[model samples]
Target chain A: MSPQHRALATREAILRAAAEEFDRLGYDAAPLSAILERSGVTKGAFYFHFPSKEALASAIVQVQDDTWPRLTGQWRDRGLDPLRTLIGLFEEAVSLLSRDVVLRAGVRLAADRDVGYPGLSSAHLRWEKVLGDLLLAARDAGQLRPGVDPEAAARTLTSAALGARLISSATCRCADFPERMREVWRLVLPGLATDEWCPPALEVLAAPQEP
Target chain B: MSPQHRALATREAILRAAAEEFDRLGYDAAPLSAILERSGVTKGAFYFHFPSKEALASAIVQVQDDTWPRLTGQWRDRGLDPLRTLIGLFEEAVSLLSRDVVLRAGVRLAADRDVGYPGLSSAHLRWEKVLGDLLLAARDAGQLRPGVDPEAAARTLTSAALGARLISSATCRCADFPERMREVWRLVLPGLATDEWCPPALEVLAAPQEP
Candidate 1:
């Protein structure tokens, strides 16, 4: 392999190691030495890639931020209704959280205040904005109930989703995330969507998806 | 003051100090020395009341556990409808969380996993049971809509409340806790309650109480 290709590979390996450590033992408790050992990379290579633990964590958050827009963009391109697209985005997020340790670590780190990563709240703020925009679109399309405020609904839904993920992580290691999210949408949709939109929204939530 | 009263006051002071430290620095970073300095109690006096940090945290959890039942019991004794009683309980919780630093600290510590406090999940489980029972009573009273599962609804509400508290704590130092919780109920009640019960539930949420 070319030198550049090898360099990229080494960086990726370090990020994976850091993510696993952070995921297992939180940001404060995760030791850099353990990450180096797990990656099987020399201390020199580790330093070349990540100067500090915070730097590694920040990189993980960046990757998470990058991944989200791409996933949502794909759903947006599908030309589905705004509400369906919002559900699709959550469905995608559940999959990513379950499949990607780096993403999960990023989320956990973001939720932790002691991490001191400004990027953490930025990520949440971004999601809230995305949800708000979608809800506005849904309202314009007559999919939303008459009295529902898009911004308030967006905040509640976002907070509820974050809360569900935290509970699932603590209680079941997220094995039940999809089911938990399904229940949240089940409880929330009737309140947010117009009567004509409720059946289809429920259908979207009930449709089978890969875990 | 009597000897018993003095001892109780000292114990309470120590718990308050520990909670402040824990709330500011998190569990792993909060040092016993900081708590000691803040409480102005000698090390010997501190140890006499609480043997260890974990022990202290456990005591805080115990205090929090004790507080909830008394608050809920007050509402239950009022002989209000179950749904109204539940709203009153949440309103009381909002006040306790805002007015009581120790309670806030206990909640933050309980949500934290690295604290290694076994009592944390127990606190949450106990709350879930309380909410479940209240929801079941509401269902029987015909307040809840048909096909709503009391256990699942209780879990969702509990998780949502936790999530809202976390968000409020992060965004506004919990200054917005009551407003955030009100928004949560405003969005959730419609889906959970029968149409006839919706206005009364909203009214209960909107009613102001002494904090």
Candidate 2:
């Protein structure tokens, strides 16, 4: 492998190890020494990449953002109908959160630990704004129902999605978090759905029956 | 005041001050010296009431639980028909959260921090059972539709409520957390609602906008 490729691989390895440590022990209790030991990397290399644990946290948040399709790009590409994109994005998010433990942990931590962290908050707001702008764009297109507050509705939907994940992960015994999530979304999405799309048939999505 | 009254007053004062300090600075960062100053008590008295900060934290959680009406009583009273009651509880919780920053912070901290702390998880589970039992009762009464997993659904609702608080607090300015909570409950309740009531109608009961 090229020198650049080797460096990238080492960085990704450190981040994966850090994510596991942070998730298992939490942000405060997780120590750099433990991460170094787990990653099998020397202290010098870890410090070279991340000056502090908080900096490493920022890196993790960035990685999470990069892994998903950017909300802005996704919405904008939907041909001026942002609401369609917004729903699609949430559907995608539910899928990602259901399938990936790292994503779920990262999201929960984002809600809990990163509220006080500026870099994380900024990235979070940027994402929220992308959603907010989509709402605004939909409003401009006359797709939203009358009297809807674009920003407020957007935040409400965003918050509900986060809430769905929290519910599924902490409480559900079901193996796929997404399975539970779609049900929560069905209840949540109708209120936010634009006048253009007929409400998806409100079905009673249920748990798999035992043998 | 009598001597006994004075002593009791001092202890309560210390606990109130300790709660504020602990909530703001967390267990490790909150110094007893500051709490002592806030309560105007000597270190001897502070140590007399509480041996360590951990003890103080435990006391604070206990005091809050006593003061707060968790879902337990609500679930019991509305046992056979809990869909509306559970939704009503979230509505009440959201309004209460708006007025009390301490409660909001404390609850979120309890959810995140208590997993490692002894006794807390058990207490949390006990609360969960209260909610679970209510859901089971509702199922037997035909409130929850067929194929709805009572335990899983109850946990999902609880987790969503916690996550909603986190999101609301995290983005306090962008959204009114209380109102958004109503929106969340609106979505969650319908799936669990009986055939006669539609979800939006519950919103009118919980949060009727002025004419």
Candidate 3:
């Protein structure tokens, strides 16, 4: 590989291993030595890439930002109905957060102490806007139930989804996250979406790949 | 002072100081020395009250259990309707959690990488049962809307409140927790409770002291 490519690979290696340490041990408890050993990178190489433990953590959080918009764009491209896309996005976000070590570490670090609240983050805003925009589209298409305020629905959806993620993590270590989310959506959709729209959306959420 | 009384006072001091340390700096980050200094106790005195930092944490968590029942009973005595009582409980729980250092420490420790999920705790079960029983009572009283599942409502309320607490902690350090809970209830109540019941409950939640 070219020198530039090798440099990129080295950076990625450090991040992956560091995320594992942080996700397993938490930011305060995570050991820099463990990260370096896990990454199989030399001390000089590690220092060249990340000057401190905090720097490595910041990168993981930065990568999380990069991941979100791409995933949001990909799901939107499927051309499914808007609320359907919204449900699909919720399910997929939970799934990714459950299994993806890097993303999980980013989320955990982002939560530690307020540099800021995730609610106030651009990502939070972006996430809310994504849900909000979808709800607006659903409303325009008459997919929402009568008198449903799309903005409230969007904020509720975002907050509820955030709550479900933490709740599942705290309750079952995310073992039953998809199931927990399905239950939440079941109640939320009937309240927020039109009668005709909710049933199929629930069906699709229960089994996203079945066409 | 009586020897036994002084011992109890000493124990309270240690727990209070330790909770401040733990809440300020998470479990792994909190220093034993600072807890000792802040409590104004010697190491021997501190150990006499609590064997270890984890013990202090355990005691704090245990103390939390004691606090819950007393608070629950006190609120129940107010003789409000089931739904209002429910909203009152959420608001109070969030309010207590926001400012009570001991409760904050217990909650933070409870969420660490896990001996278990808070959801599986007896406290979680009790919390769920409390909400569930209230919802069932509401349904029987015709305060709940048609087709609202008391069991699901109970679980959802429990999860959502748990979520709201964590979300607020992560987002704003709980500065606007009351406002956040109010927003969540606004979206939630309409779905689960009668329209007439919801407005007044929301009003009470917005200002709990007013008649």
DockQ per candidate, 2 decimals: 0.39, 0.28, 0.24
Residue range B151-200, candidate 1, lDDT tens digits: 88887887677666666666665678787778888888999999999998
Top model number, DockQ: 1
Model 2 misses residue A127 by how many Å? 4.2
The digit string of per-residue lDDT tens for model 1 on A63-133 reads 87788999989989999999999998988898778778888887767655434211125466678899999
Superposition error at B176 for model 1 (Å): 1.4
lDDT of 3 by residue, B1-211 (tens): 9999999999989988998877666677788898999999888888787888888888888777787788888778999888878888877887888878788777666555244332123466578888888789888888988877888777676766665665566555566666666666766776777877877876776674321
Model 3 misplacement above 4 A: A1-65, A75-85, A95-156, A170-175, A189-211, B1-11, B41-48, B76-79, B116-122, B208-211
C-alpha lDDT of all candidate models, in order: 0.80, 0.59, 0.75
Model 2, range A143-200, lDDT digits (tens) per residue?
A: 6666567776655555544544444454541145565555555544444555354253
Q: Distance from true position, residue B9, model 3, in Å?
A: 5.0
Provide the lDDT at B149 for model 1. 86
Sorted by TM-score, highest first, which candidate order results?
Answer: 1, 2, 3
Q: Please list the residue runs of candidate 2 whose C-alpha ends up more than 4 Å from where it truly belongs after superposition.
A: A40-58, A65-71, A97-127, A136-152, A166-175, A194-211, B66-71, B78-81, B94-109, B116-156, B170-177, B187-195, B198-211
